[model samples]
Target: MTAIVARPVSVKLDQETRGRIDRLATSRRRTTHWLMREAIQQYIEREEKLEAYRQNGIAAWEAYQASGLHVTQEEADAWLAKLEAGEDVEPPACHV
Candidate 1:
């Protein structure tokens, strides 16, 4: 097994927030440092997913503008409804 190396980070938290973290750590039977690290990891993962979504939206918008090819909302809704109903259906065609 490879050894994991972690660097120490310094953060100044207000008294109220520190107290809350301490209480939660005690309740969860975890160290405050572990709680903080887990919180930071979760935050990073959530933000990364959000960033990817934003980028995909921007790319789709640009593609739509360039090609003027998109399915109508009604068409999309029908396709989604069929999928939700466990029916196999082809996606709607994009229009000029």
Candidate 2:
């Protein structure tokens, strides 16, 4: 495993938000710095997942435009029904 080297970054917050975080940190028995770090880390992770999903969607759209291959909504519904019924079936084949 690799070690993590941290650096300092400064952010300016208004007094109301700063006081809220301080009060919540005090209630949670954690330092304000730790709360900020955890919040930033979680926000980054969630946004990264959203970004990857967006990219995948763009790629799929491009591929569909190139090949014109797709399955109908009825076929998709049937596959979903099977899965909902606990059947381990393969997905429907795509067609032009």
Candidate 3:
């Protein structure tokens, strides 16, 4: 098995936040360090997902501008409504 390398860092929390973290860690029978590490890991994952979504939107916009292919609002709304109603519906065809 491969060994994991760890680095140590310091953070300063406000009094109220520190108190909350301490209380929560105690309740969960975990160390404050574990709680903080878990919180930072979750935060990084969420931010990375958001960044990927933003990049995908930018790419889609550029593609649409270049190809001039898209569906009308009405068609998109119809497709979305069908999806919301639990119907298996294909998306509207993109057109100029």
Candidate 4:
């Protein structure tokens, strides 16, 4: 295991927003800093997943444009349904 080095960061907020965060933090018995850090962590994770999905879509599009090979919607649905029923099965083969 490795130790993590913590660094200080500064963020500016409006008076009303600061007050709102302070009230929530007091009620939850947590520091405003903790809430802000958690919110940032979650936002980053979600955005990373979205970016990966976008890249995968771009790759799949390029592959289809090059090879003109794919499975039909019905074939894909059937293969997915088999898996949903807890059966171990391979995916449908791609075709031109």
Candidate 5:
């Protein structure tokens, strides 16, 4: 058995949506609050992914600048073109 913490929240729904929620809850033997919590959890997970991507982009740009390598838009395009052409460019050697 697992212990769960629950909170009380107030939400307003129109008559039609309220009726639908009641029917679904009755059919599935679930409370509307459980469904809402699951929906919110999924939304939070997606937003977290976007936040991670933003952080990774910022980190990569800062690393590039710290490396003292001058990178231009033309060089970026050329690298992309090489990548698109399936050229085997060796990975940058890292100094530990």
Candidate 6:
């Protein structure tokens, strides 16, 4: 059998809120501390997902800048014209 160690913590809440938590814990056959811990864990997981998205955006922008090339209006028009004419246009200088 595995044994789990528990720690003591203190928090303050309004009487109504405390009553609600107590009711919920009783109905769910769980302790208020357990419910609070589960809620906090879920919140942390959500924050991690948001942070990953933010980091991916920053990395994509850096990659675009590092590619070190830009297409002007005329260049864009020429590329489009070539594509419309069914001509094979080589990739831009920045691309492999």
lDDT of 4: 0.96
RMSD of each: 1.7, 1.6, 1.5, 2.3, 5.0, 7.8
Query: In candidate 6, what are the lDDT values of residues 1-96, reduced to their tens digit?
Result: 899987877888899998998899999999998888887789999999999999999987788788755666677788888989999997444432
Against the unseen true structure, what C-alpha lDDT does each candidate score?
0.98, 0.99, 0.98, 0.96, 0.80, 0.84
Counted clashes in each candidate structure: 0, 0, 0, 0, 0, 0
Candidate that beats the other on lDDT, 1 or 2, i.e. the better one = 2
| Model 3 C-alpha lDDT per residue in residues 1-96, reported as the tens digit of each score | 999999899898899999999999999999999999999999999999999999999999999999999999999999999999999999999999
Candidate 1 collision pairs: none
Candidate 1, superposed: residue stretches over 4 Å from native:
1-4
Question: What order do candidates take by TM-score, descending?
Answer: 2, 1, 3, 4, 6, 5
Give Cα distance to truth, residue 36, candidate 5, Å.
0.4
C-alpha TM-scores of all predictions: 0.91, 0.93, 0.88, 0.80, 0.52, 0.54
TM-score of 6: 0.54
**Which number leads on lDDT?**
2
Q: On residues 1-96, what C-alpha lDDT tens digit does candidate 5 reach at each position?
A: 999978787888899988998888788899987777776799999999999999999998898778855556676677778888999775444442
4 against 5, candidate with superior TM-score: 4
lDDT of 1 by residue, 1-96 (tens): 999998898999999999999999999999999999999999999999999999999999999999999999999999999999999999999999
Sort every candidate by lDDT, greatest first: 2, 1, 3, 4, 6, 5
* lDDT score for residue 50 of model 4: 100
Q: Give the per-residue Cα lDDT of candidate 2 at 42.
A: 100
lDDT tens readout by residue for model 4, 10-96? 999999999999999899999999988988999999999999999999999999999999999999999999999999999999999
Q: After superposition, how far is residue 44 of candidate 4 from its true place, in Å?
A: 1.0
Between candidates 3 and 5, the lDDT winner: 3
